[model samples]
Target: MSSDPGEPARRALERARQSIQKIHQAAIRHRDPSLHEIADEMSEVALILGHDAGPVQDWRPCPVCGAEPGSHCIQRPGHEMVNGMHPERSRL
Candidate 1:
């Protein structure tokens, strides 16, 4: 094959494109908020409005973000790790 100096950059751009696509997929897959945390936040809002407290319940850690305090972070399960240009799903 004839050597082309731009081949490496082209390949790099393609790799970057694939990587960005994987991130996009991950974000789309994990865009929902936690229902439990939603309720908690609603309760806080109610209190601000002079209403009764919202429902209080134990915070459950997302499997992807294990052991972290409730911040309602998105959980993509096995997608936390990179496998090639895509994220590998967690089997846990």
Candidate 2:
């Protein structure tokens, strides 16, 4: 039987979605004490999605304290660390 024209496009889209999902999962798995690394990875993914190609060089720093991208400002508690804190904080 001949294949439908739409089938290839649908399959490609599905594969792309799965690939993005896997990347997001890996980024989650690589969470760290400061989460700077994970944030960078997520930023790269966002760039792939046509979102802001950031955190841009000219992006405004955190106005309250001038914190820059990748800076682990004490005021900005990392989501990954917060989730893993209870038992892992000591190990980190």
Candidate 3:
């Protein structure tokens, strides 16, 4: 029924990693007792709030066939497009 007073802030920071780093840093710097816990929480938070992997540019090249940047992954021979898969960072 009752949650830790810091729970709300922690939860918020967990979801607010990308946009609120400075705020999280300031808060974390001031709080020493739970420094480890905060560090751990922020690690997970960064992953959760990090890059937008859903975009095509975020995908990796197809292991089945080497493709060019901004190009569709072709499962060659028949040359089928793997629409489900996008490329990772561009080669450049």
Candidate 4:
């Protein structure tokens, strides 16, 4: 067993990223018009899965909870973490 608690998640994410890369390469080799579309979609998925995706939207702080940029907003006392980011935060 691995000692690191996040090892599983890290491995899964890496695998997904690699799969996307392979699919993109295959699409390029085929040279079909539809394959080009698939390649574009895979490129978008790669960007979203990249390390730069850690941040929320903008660099500004959350208007509601004042959560700093790159950090998720804090939930209310009875709210779940999934609901933490305030709707107002996206307005920026």
Top lDDT prediction, candidate number: 4
Better of 3 and 4 by TM-score: 4
Q: Give the candidate number with the greatest TM-score.
A: 4
Stretches off by above 4 angstroms in model 4 are 42-92
Model 1, residue 22: displacement in angstroms?
0.5
Worst 10 residues of 2 by lDDT: 83-92
For all candidates in order, the CA lDDT equals: 0.42, 0.41, 0.42, 0.54
Candidate number that wins on TM-score, 2 or 3: 2
Reference-based TM-score, model 1: 0.32
Give the alpha carbon lDDT tens digit for every residue of 2-48 in model 1.
Answer: 39998886676556445434443343356533543454454556566
Model 3 misplaced regions, further than 4 Å: 1-46, 50-53, 57-59, 77-92
State each candidate's clash count. Answer: 3, 0, 4, 0
lDDT (Cα, tens digit) per residue for candidate 3, span 20-44 = 4443344445644244335335455
Clashing pairs in 4: none
Q: Tens digit of lDDT per residue, candidate 4, span 1-92?
A: 99999999888767765665455445445544364345345545656666322222333356667775546788766544445577765441
Q: Candidate 1: give the clashing pairs.
A: 43-54, 78-89, 78-90
Candidate 2: tens digits of C-alpha lDDT, residues 1-92 = 44798787667655655554444345445533234444445556756776543222212223333445333323444433333122222121
Give the candidates in order of TM-score, highest first. 4, 2, 1, 3
Worst 10 residues of 1 by lDDT: 83-92
* Predictions: Cα RMSD each: 18.7, 12.0, 13.0, 13.0
TM-score of 2: 0.34
